[model samples]
Target: MIALPFLKSAPPPLQGERLYLRPPQLSDYKAWATLRAQSRDFLVPWEPLWAVDDLERSAFRHRIRHYDEEAAAGTAYPFFLFRNTDSRLIGGITLGNIRRGVGQNGMIGYWVGEPFAGQGYMYEALRLIIPYAFTKLRLHRLEAACIPSNERSIRLLEKAGFQKEGLLRSYLKINGMWQNHLLFSLIEDDRWR
Candidate 1:
């Protein structure tokens, strides 16, 4: 796989005031499964339909392998968010669909366990990943999309300085149906503004 210069090595764990982000691992299955099970109802509406074996150990192993491949190919960086105080897994974030050359862009996607929602963990995760995407990965723009009805995501994107671009018609098949999504973006030059 061709590697971008900036992604020649796996990213170091990103540290923040209340949490840190690291890649998924085999040892994380139990915590990950428990969290997802608890948050299934909370997350399902905003996500693609989950496979019957989505939380099974074997499926998680496949997910880890896929994450490894995406990272190796410099197409995406996926991280699991963990609280600092007790080292509990709180959520996850990804900078995916990376475009190189003139585009120099990527898409951001995230999810937080229900118990950890509305607590600013996702915001901090964004704070860490945005700079990493801009400086370390040299992305010129970062984009995110969410279902229009997802007020929480809309607020989070705005708070993180992403400007609403427009609506995408049936952009993603979420929850087993094609759903309209609002697109938001933050350019590298917009970071400090």
Candidate 2:
């Protein structure tokens, strides 16, 4: 078996013309909860639920613990995407479910603030994250799965150069129901070698 390399506590914060992606923190709680809760309807179809607990600082503290552990183990990078120039936490994007060794891959997941949707922020976050995953973390592939009807998400992945590999039937349980997702991925060294 290949020995696991020590993981970085955090990836260097990423920047773009308008946005930056950084590790989550307790200070981000209020903004994160507000945005996510306000976007409940928009996010519900895509996510599980807006647990009352998810809106609490105590819950966020627990979440940060899990996030920090995942970071140390090199298994995940759950980022809060912000608009740097404005200092606004617009949404979240996570490089989750990472696997090392011969696979060297991770999955991408994200959501944009309700009001911030259609402004290309999700695209910007994805653009920054894909390269970060493949180049900095040396991951071999970046994968994303979207509900076939989630046009915005599918569009973002395609714009970032992920190709559809297949459709999974009842691949994941979302909002308490088994749902389908169209799987997409980009192999490293293919576009950014």
Candidate 3:
């Protein structure tokens, strides 16, 4: 694949009090799979339908390749969130839709493991990723989309300084159906504006 406009870019490693962001690795498959499976009930309403044996090694290998390709191309960084003390994979997040030049913008997407939820891991992940976007990628804006009913995610984004812009009606087919989202964003200037 051709490189993204921000081809020189790469995801910066980020760390926080309880969480860290790192490139996803093959070793993470088992932990990631188990998290997803265990969180199925907790994640289904926010994600797609459970695919057939998606946790299998073959599928995971494909995903690893995809993550590597996207990260190398600077189109996205499929990162794993880890609990700092034990360095255990607790979730996945990505910075995508990178636009360079004047816009210098990107979007953040993430999912936290069920057991890790409500413990502020997602919030810490956002805290780390947003700064990485602004400083390392030199991004001017960062965006996030969350289902209106996803109170936890909404709170996390808001806590990270993203302001709700508006609602996108039936904007995406999440969980196999059209879903509305509350669009939120933070601009670089907003940091000190």
lDDT of each: 0.94, 0.87, 0.83
Q: Model 2, 1-193: lDDT tens per residue?
A: 6554547677678988899999998899989888888888888899975576777889889999999989988899999989977889999889999988778899999989899999999888888888888777889998899999998888888887889999999999898889999999999866632
Query: Which digits, one per residue and each the tens of the lDDT, describe model 3 over residues 53-139?
Result: 788988998988988888776778778999889988899899988876667799889998889889888887887787777776778
Candidates arranged by lDDT, highest first: 1, 2, 3
Which one wins by TM-score: 2 or 3? 2
Task: Give the per-residue Cα lDDT of candidate 2 at 114.
Answer: 93
Please give each candidate's TM-score.
Answer: 0.97, 0.94, 0.91
Instruction: After the best TM-score superposition of candidate 3, give how far the Cα of residue 40 lies from its true spot, in angstroms.
Output: 0.8
Clashing residue pairs in candidate 2 (N, C-alpha, C atoms within 3 angstroms): none
* Candidate 1's TM-score: 0.97
> Can you tell me which runs of candidate 3 are displaced by over 4 Å?
1-12
Instruction: Give RMSD (Å) of candidate 1 vs. truth.
Output: 1.6
Total clashing pairs in model 3: 0
Candidate that would win on lDDT: 1
